[model samples]
Target: MMGTKLQVAVIGGGAAGLCAARHLLSRGDRFAPPVVYEVSDSVGGTWIYTDSVGTDRHGLPVHSSMYRNLRTNLPKEVMAFPGFPFGPHLPSFIHHSDVRRYLEEYAQHYGIGEHIKLFTEYPLPISSSSTRSRSRTLKEEDQKSYHPEEVAIKSFTYIIIRNRHYSDPYIPNVPGMEYFQGQVMHSHEYRTPESFTGKRVVLLGAGPSGIDIALELSQVAQEVILSHSRPPIASPLPGNVIQAPGVDRLSEASVLFQDGTERRADAFILCTGYNYSFPFLAEEVGLKVEGGVVSPLYKYVVHTRFTSLCFIGLCKAVCPFPHFNCQVLFSLAVLDGSCPLPPERELNAATAEELRARLESGFPARHFHKLDSLQWDYNNELAQLGRFEPLSPILKELYENCKAIRGRDLINYKSYNYKISSGSSREWSLLCPQ
Candidate 1:
């Protein structure tokens, strides 16, 4: 048993951060009240959308990538935190505003707001040339305002780098971008489609955001070319929307595709994806994200060498809220000594081996943290190891059912509602209009 309550510093106030704070608060005997760092006044993290992009008033890079008119592709049934369900009357598929409201209510219910430090920015410690003095100074500043009791960060203190992963948008280097002479933007800057009316737009990825933006733009854009290297989408597309091969290069005013075809593009949007960024981390800490893979992490949550530094929600294609719950619980268990962690060397080897197997199976280096069908198994494993109740099987059933449904009917998938049968053996009911 720990002699003193451990102080946890939670970075970011999104769902993952809030989940960490809530769970930490619930364990009052074992934990000091958490200190949550958030850039905005709100606690919804990336779910909080703003008209402004690029930078905030404080000049911090905007953390949210949410564009206007985004609805939850995953139903609320699968999206809610394990124990906290959304309102019964709400549509299974909800708007971003509704999702934000849910997060706000959750924060209030758990009294997490009282512990949150708002409008705070954590500079990447490495940004300063001198690492030791910089880390000490930053720690001293943070120790001043910890409410209920101001406490010094001792050896047992844990830092949760919960800065959700959608901020650092990735746009691959395409040759001739300088001479293209067209307005090029990442989907992060996209707010609404009205500005591109009558313009021929080339969207340089076919990820969910890329496809959704194409649908949204089809209503306004004169022509939409969805450029991708993935297999062709089977869903019926709008008349103006056309699928094209990946871009080989760009000319003065057009994009050259790998198939040797060329398309005139008035504008270009890169929906490529994001990088795993932790600017606040110093080099001595030994975390690396190369080829879109974050390493030296055991179970992708705990730092192998420095177990005191934990990360939440570094994953992709997950039931984000539930995943956060499992991750937080397991991390706490490890930190509190209820569940012991392996040695640093063993942890590193195990971590590397799993990733190597994934790569050898033909998955790309960028998909190191992807947990699609694997998410259910991953979540259950954490619960088992952490001695917590496993997530209900019905959640997986609903999630996969919705995925198949969405794949076949992208346009009308969100229209369908789902209801979870009450109790442990959670049979689900799919609701469709008469």
Candidate 2:
């Protein structure tokens, strides 16, 4: 009983969850096999593409925002988890199906798929008596499949929420939305660009998804107005696509641009991004999402009050799989007493100080978790704290270079091929100039 393995319940069998499970299995002496609860039948989280939108057959909202012809923006070299590289035969940037298959392969290679509890709901309210948390309602009768004893716990049960924030799409609020009602939709509902053929579409937000969707629609749409608050993208857009300032508001038949221009749009698609929703987290958890920032999370992984409660894949503008790996290791270290966390007050103060520093540096409160270039150091700190190997230096170099390439030509950036040399060379290169 003294050496009993810790029970870990991973909510969401996405890449992050799988990483958590893999590490948990790696340290069999410390951790029991993680029970990964995934709402979908598969393990690929948002990468699992579906043509269906709005709801699934079970009447649940569709979580995948993948559209047809979508490909990974990050090259497989950087996208892959450490020690597990994407196939050499595969291109640098690959199709969504390839990415899905990569995740499946990662799960299988680590025997993580066997530990996954598919279609299982998670994070029901934590029982006051025991540290064990009861799972909420399951969809249909899939609850019958999982053995409750597997998720049983005594002390704190580690909850690794590999939750995909992309599920909750966020459309910017503009005044007078009730007046001009075209086929207003979020990027989540976009499956194929064929329906927009011969239509005037005004897409909101200039993020990667917005620009990508606009480019796709240009293949069919007669006119595409890409609206955004960010500086005008210098890259050449398709003939049918044009750039405009952010939308001021909507009239009965037109949208007014911030620069005093107006356009009658047949469809308005919001690529504004999404809200981080953890519906499974009970109210007592004390975690809060305010203005797009999830708080009480020290260093973005460990919950200050609930030390065993950890989050993965929450930071944006990052190389996801490796980031998840670092976070998972750090979480396990905290739980296993390898990386002892600070006291509650110190933890909260650290979180507050980090936020305050970022805010003072001109980062918007809503974009506090947008790590971008800061992810390299964040990952390194996690590795240093958790006693795990940090990511290769070349990965960050490649990542930054790719961002520049994407900015130079978003339309053709995916055409490039890259290769990271094997072992401690810590070097990478562009394979071919496309």
Candidate 3:
């Protein structure tokens, strides 16, 4: 086993999965080229917008949650992968289709497309409910599930799994929902604003999707009501939009708010975001999905209890491409025995301690994987451990500035262009979008 090239199984062909495969292919001596299992017929997982929602042609739940008019909220400068620029000509906030093309190009350029097995279903977790407390021993059946009839059963020490983190959109069940129902749907089902024309819409979340969807609906809807538990947004909403307190309940032909206010609406759109569901991985692996967070993962990549398994691209509110790059390289270093992890007991303790601290700080368990502003620190930690160059400081500065721009003007933020020059000075600028 030590003499032969290490075999790795990458579960998805999304951005994170592509990063893992690209890095593995680059290091042919230490690792074998990864076998990437993509459920879709192509790369670029969530970036690919499918007009078909609910279930796809294969009867699998539709993986993409992207809307028609969606452009990246983050600028291209921070979103580009390290060592691969998006080039100087493209606008900072490009459309999602452009992102899919860029990923396809990235795969083609690196010869990763040849190794990718598209239109394959993810293998069910080897461990079933019977083995509730212990990791499942991978048998010949598991290996066959990975490559189907093509690749033979081979002994591989490491398995790299990618979790896209954007499946199973969530909509909280409000009481009395059955009483007043016009059209109830989640943002994942949303394709265009045309269906909502001239209607009174109630959006039940103020996250990025809610804000973006409300803005899109404002153009076509007669009136849009944004109901949320949080305090009002700092930025002013459009004139046609109304901010309401959290929903208390609903009645026939009316909606009740916590403030005792009532409004009647034609449709209900839940932008409440998604849940963390890894249907492929069983519970015996010492991982738990309570609320929206997957737990007991050291560094949010490796399974602390099962060292051979690692998950990529699970963190939320991150600079995804660059974040995936760092996570992938660090994971490879761990697999190659270049970067040593802590003992199993220490790993479990560290994971628990991190969650304890976060909970003590008043953050919900659902946000355990949200990196948000803390992603810069997480990236540096990985780079230092993996012995790779850390991301430039300018990226963090520019990222924060982008958040500020969004807060100041959600509608006009995408209109600005951004650039981050290379070298020590690392000049950053924001110009008008072309």
Candidate 4:
């Protein structure tokens, strides 16, 4: 606050944004009070938007939206912030509502809530010609002509946001979807189950949401049809939960499959996920999306050429909140001159194509930008930034012992299992009556 501090903007007020902001403050480096722009009136991005108390479009109530008695997938020990451990009475897996509350608590504990600018949307700004040029050279007269405002603007940078909540649902073109549907709606519009009580329902896709709805309506609806292009993996756990083999495909829904084997239904709930897109940035920004996958950028951290601007929570197959927060802190350290940026190369056409091929190879042709396991990813990121040394043998043994205990299931709540040994305090309950 004393000198001219660098200006930074953080987009989105979800867990990722809060984590980034907290790290920025922790660094206590010379920087302007970082501005956090949240487009919603409240903080919780996806938690608030999701159907927490009502029915879904398929007439499945709020209770059906979530897995029956589901708990947090991650244990409390790893899920919580660095200093704030989950206290006693920790459940193996907490409820979604409890998770939302914990997010709010994290924001409050770190004093980040006060810094956030709610109800603000960020539309990407046009890049000025002077700012884009690669040449750093300036003429004698040009140097004298520079104004204070121009210099400050040049130094300022931004952090872009991408998440499931931002994406608009993708509903593919089916031949007679318009003709025979009694009631049709995308998952975005779905709210409750009162409407489908006695009606036959056909829920499309076999992802977590689709499976949840199918199981909820099976008993109430005359018949519940789960239509999928490929059979789900269906991993059977202690409870009657089935983990889908992989992500679902939207294009697989063809007229033939619908007519040949699919059951007729009173309504169709398309649980198909969203597409990879950013409405704000222009195509020339060099953020490439090939075959539904964004081009690989520097160990999935900072953009190769654009060091000032960073992205968080873009990786798939990992929990974005805590993992991304840890990654963002490392990135911030580099940006603040506390650490050095990792060595990386500019993405070329071939690299982009390779990423595209890798994304398509997954079970369902969807682009969530998959990565490896959480712990390994976190460790690699820390190493890339040169932030942490290898754990000592004693510490490593202790950590492994903790992970083993956390992995055990103590309570079988259907899709929600509580890993008692995980010692997660953030995992709480969101109990909805049947």
Best lDDT goes to which candidate? 2
TM-score top scorer: 2
Task: List the candidate 4 regions with Cα displacement exceeding 4 Å.
Answer: 1-4, 50-78, 85-90, 123-155, 160-166, 232-259, 337-368, 372-375, 386-434
The root-mean-square deviation over C-alpha atoms between each candidate and the true structure, in angstroms, is 4.5, 2.9, 4.6, 10.2
lDDT of candidate 4 over 1-434, digit per residue (tens): 64656566676677777777877777665666666766545576555535433443323222122333335545454466555555546553566667667778888988898888654444344232113211121222333332211111232454535343334567777656756637777655665666778876667777546655665665467666667766543433223222222212222232225334434457767888656555555455576655555544554556666666667766654544546655676676667777765454434443455455665766333443554343454445555574644222222233344334433422223323233232433222323223
Regions of model 1 farther than 4 Å from truth: 1-3, 123-156
Candidate 3 per-residue lDDT over residues 1-434, each given as its tens digit: 43688777787899999999999999999887777778766899999898889876545568898889888889888898887878678989998898998899899889999888665656555342212111122233443232333333334466677776677887688998887768888998898999999999999999888999999999999999999988788887789999999999887777889999999899988888888777777656667788776867889998777777888988999999999999998898888889989898999898889888999998898888888999999999999999999998888998999999899887788899986666757797788655
Residue pair clashes in candidate 3: none
| Model 2, CA-based lDDT | 0.84
Q: What TM-score against the true fold does each predicted structure earn?
A: 0.92, 0.94, 0.92, 0.70
Q: Which clashing pairs does model 2 show? A: none
Assess each prediction's global lDDT (C-alpha) against the native.
0.84, 0.84, 0.82, 0.53
Tell me how far the alpha carbon of residue 258 in candidate 1 is from the true structure, in angstroms, after superposition. 0.7
Candidate 3's C-alpha runs over 4 A off are 1-3, 127-155
Error of 1 at 385 (Å): 1.0
What lDDT does candidate 4 reach at residue 99? 63
